[model samples]
Target chain A: MHADPIGVLTGAHFIDGDHACSEGAIAAGCRFVAGYPITPSTEVVERIAERFPFVGGVFIQMEDEIASSIAIQGAVWGGKKAMTVTSGPGFSLMMEHIGLAAMTETPCVFVDVQRAGPSTGLPTMPAQGDMMQARWGSHGDYQIIAIVPNSPQECFDLTVHAFNLSERYRVPVMMMMDECVGHMIERVVIPSADKIEVHNRKVYDGPKESYRAFETGRDLIPSMVKAGDGYRIHVTGLTHDEKGYPDMSVSAQGKLVQRLMDKIRIHADDIVMYKEEDVEGADVVVVSFGITSRTAIPAIEQARAKGLKVGHLRLVVVWPFPEKRIRELAGKVKSIVVPELNMGQIVYEVERCAAGKCNVVSVPHAGGTVHQPKDILAAIEKSLRGT
Target chain B: MPRNEIKIGGFGGQGVILSGYILGRAASIYDSKYATMIQAFGPEARGSACSAQLIISDEPISYPYIVAPNVMVLMSQEAYSKFTPELAPGGILLTEEDLVVTHNLRADVRHFSIPATRIAEELGKRLVLNIVMLGFATALTNLVGRDAARNAVKVSVPKGTEELNFAAFEKGYEYGLQLLKKEPEKILA
Candidate 1:
């Protein structure tokens, strides 16, 4: 069923928002997609359901978002790169599973197409309000990878990256996309299959009796064993021991929780991805992501054209947020202008990273649309003057 | 490598964006002029102001949206008023005459007025005016192939509706050719 099993497949054609997202899931070697039909995200599943049958995979429209997320969690354990997409309201329901994926250290991808919302504010309109929620909505102390792509093309490309990051480091990944990016049509080069590096979960080949779900050396990432395998795999939500048994003993629970945190915290650099632009001899740096980044690109050029000596940086990987790079720039640049859809989600990170070396000023707007470049430039110009 | 930046704006359903994709695909896929297209949606998909920016560069282009487009195709009066000022010093603005009937045209910039909505209404669909505008757009700019644009329209149009789309484009192209005949030096000069 794989067409070009060794090389990236090539077929240039026009596709809508939903199908493009599904094609990204397929190219990422996603074997399972569990999602319920909700307006913006429904097309993602509908396309996956239609395409999965032909590609030797499964797509189930679960009863609700909770069931959908749980089914995807099961599929990931069953040795498959699984995904589930949901809109704003549906996403509200899957917050618990999002926390579960993090707590259990399960490697799976979840896509949340951000529609305007607090609670289904506007299903069709786009919003980046999910920016703050994506980082902290899932309760508990756990690090996860969250990427937001601004275009239909980025939607396709980033989903592939989400799967790669999730597998490389055993953890859940979230992809944030909005209606403008999800619904808008664009020309995206469908990558060849061979070009995509597929990573499967590590399995313990030792004696079935000796397999442990949460026991590894200094790295803290353990080898996983499927349920049907001869290895007895007992994975529970409760804080467990290296032997997969819930040990409420202080030392056992403390060791278990610390290791889960250490695995991601130690490898933060490897997981974060960002795009740095025109920092040489610059005063104000504009930090942006998602649809707002598109506008920021032009604003950066305009700032440069106006001789403001400003640069631009974009965070493709929003979680495990690029604190290192931001810290490095905060010292060099006069000020950092963060223009996002929400009031102050990502800006909080920029401010923390700044640590008073440079002021982190935020320019945000939300409701139905994206932040304009002119407003971003205005911020950049203001930052330049203030500095 | 010179990048041909084409800016299009109009109501959403007029296919302003489809024309951008058709032009990009034709030049990049078939004719081999590296192309990139961008569209910013309005809050409302149907009535709000919609725009598509197309770039055809021989070399790799870094920036996606053009701040000052080389060519501007305005489908409505509001689009014309919104975009005409943003055209780079030496740019052209193409407006549909039937709907945007205007006498206060800019003298510094080259302007062509085509009755696209009038032409499409004759073909029994107002949405096809975007195709007619594409005809006028391609005729004015030398970025994309005439044949490739036609093929792109073929791939873009929904099943069985290809013939009407083709006829609409052909009539608009012929209309553009006749309009160019009146002042050949203006376009060529």
Candidate 2:
């Protein structure tokens, strides 16, 4: 983690973007993958389709996005951690089932290697257009995890993390990748087998007949009863009680929803991840995510060369928001500029954290391209002058 | 310290990528300085002008691009047109005289036109033209050691293929050393 293997790992060969993400999933112990081919994301499935047979995993190309999403659910229920991969239009079709996974509290991973669209804008170009949708695409009130990575290497490493987080928290984890990072090829070190950490769903070791489906633990996430154990365990998408029976009562639904949200929200500090650089004596800070953040590195150097004390706060893990750190940043810097490939998505989060302690500006650009370094530098220069 | 950004451009078969990678490996594995090589892969990487950005620094590299380079190494005519304009003001341009068949008279840039492709044929391997030009680039910037660049070249290639490439690289080095000792003054300085 300290080295960012893409920058330091000289061992891996220079391969295409698709192969790297596939290797990462294999390393994460993915036993099942269901997908239908899409442009940039197709390579992910192709590489996995080739590798799965050798690794003893199931790589199924379901009829379409609907079946693709369901196959992973069936595999997960069959007691294997699973995943499905897709792009924008495919993702829209899967939202119904995304909501289903939420309701069932089924653990699986969904990889959306995003291309531009409300309805297929650019099939081959890159866009961060899906950021907001990832947080809200699946219908209804449910707590889930979505993490974004800005490079092919993070695409691999974070997919592994996404799987681990899903198993630990018992929820569907969404991996958000834009076309830029999806296509970019950097070095990806296949870590040694002993170096990899894999987490499986917690199984109830008690007597088979005694197991109850919705029984709570300290974290409020229930332990699972492996199906063949002869446990008459009930699972459902409907609002359920501790014994897994439908609860039509308003009070019971309230308690159930609160606990589900609390399981992740209360322990967010443990889940949030971000990186801050050169902030010791800075008056201006640039906050960015995904592809735009890669460009910010150059802007930071340019700003530093001009003798302006500017720093960077980059998001490696987007969800659960990393609120505490941003609030701390709000107190120190005179202003913060959050640049994204969107109009004002993540900037809103930064503004909320600032809370009038300092100025927050969204230096935004959207659609198929990234913000060039000079534009970001211009914003930093403007922020430094208080204009 | 301010780093040097060098952009190498040519059509796909010209070994533009190999040239950039050798420089990156030199700065990284051999010299132990921070370096990065980010290339754009396009349909034209084979026929049209292909390009790659090389950054070598005493500190960690920030920009993955070479927006304006301290050096421009042009292997083809299209490459010369596409990238030569972004040469850092008063920077040096090392190019193949024939590949850049048409010459530009830009007084601001110090141009050293070498017959690199013709020299490669004379040396018996047309593929080694990039290795030859890199000899000139390393000699100019000295950002990464010449020996480091040579070693990076040797290791990158396949077994048994290394011997001829080494000879090709030596021809390039001999040609480059002539530029150093024979020229009136070091333009990079």
Question: What digit string (tens of lDDT, one per residue) describes model 1 on residues B79-187?
Answer: 8777777887667778888657555666777778888888899999877888888877777667776898888889878989899999888888888788788977667
**Model 2, span B78-115: residue lDDT tens:** 88888887888888788887878645657778667677
lDDT values, one for every candidate: 0.79, 0.77
Clash totals in order: 5, 1
- For residue A123, give model 1's deviation from the true position in Å: 3.0
The C-alpha TM-scores of every prediction are 0.84, 0.83
Number of the predicted model whose DockQ against the real structure is largest: 1
- The runs of at least 3 residues in candidate 1 whose Cα sits more than 4 Å from the true structure, single-residue gaps closed, are A1-9, A13-18, A39-43, B1-20, B31-133, B158-168, B185-189
Displacement of residue A324 (Cα, Å) in model 1 is 2.5
Q: What value does the TM-score of chain B take for model 2?
A: 0.91
First chain TM-score for all predictions: 0.95, 0.93
DockQ metric, candidate 2: 0.22
Task: Pull out the clashing pairs in model 2.
Answer: B12-B45
lDDT of candidate 2 over A1-387, digit per residue (tens): 222232122354444445566777777777799998886688889988887777778999989999999889888877887889889899888888887887777889988888767688777766777777777787667777888876666776787788888888888888888776776544455566556667777878887666777777788888876566677867777888887788999987898888878878977887787778887788888988777778898888898999989988888778778788888988888989888877778888888888988888778775666678898999888876653
Q: Point to the candidate with the largest TM-score.
A: 1
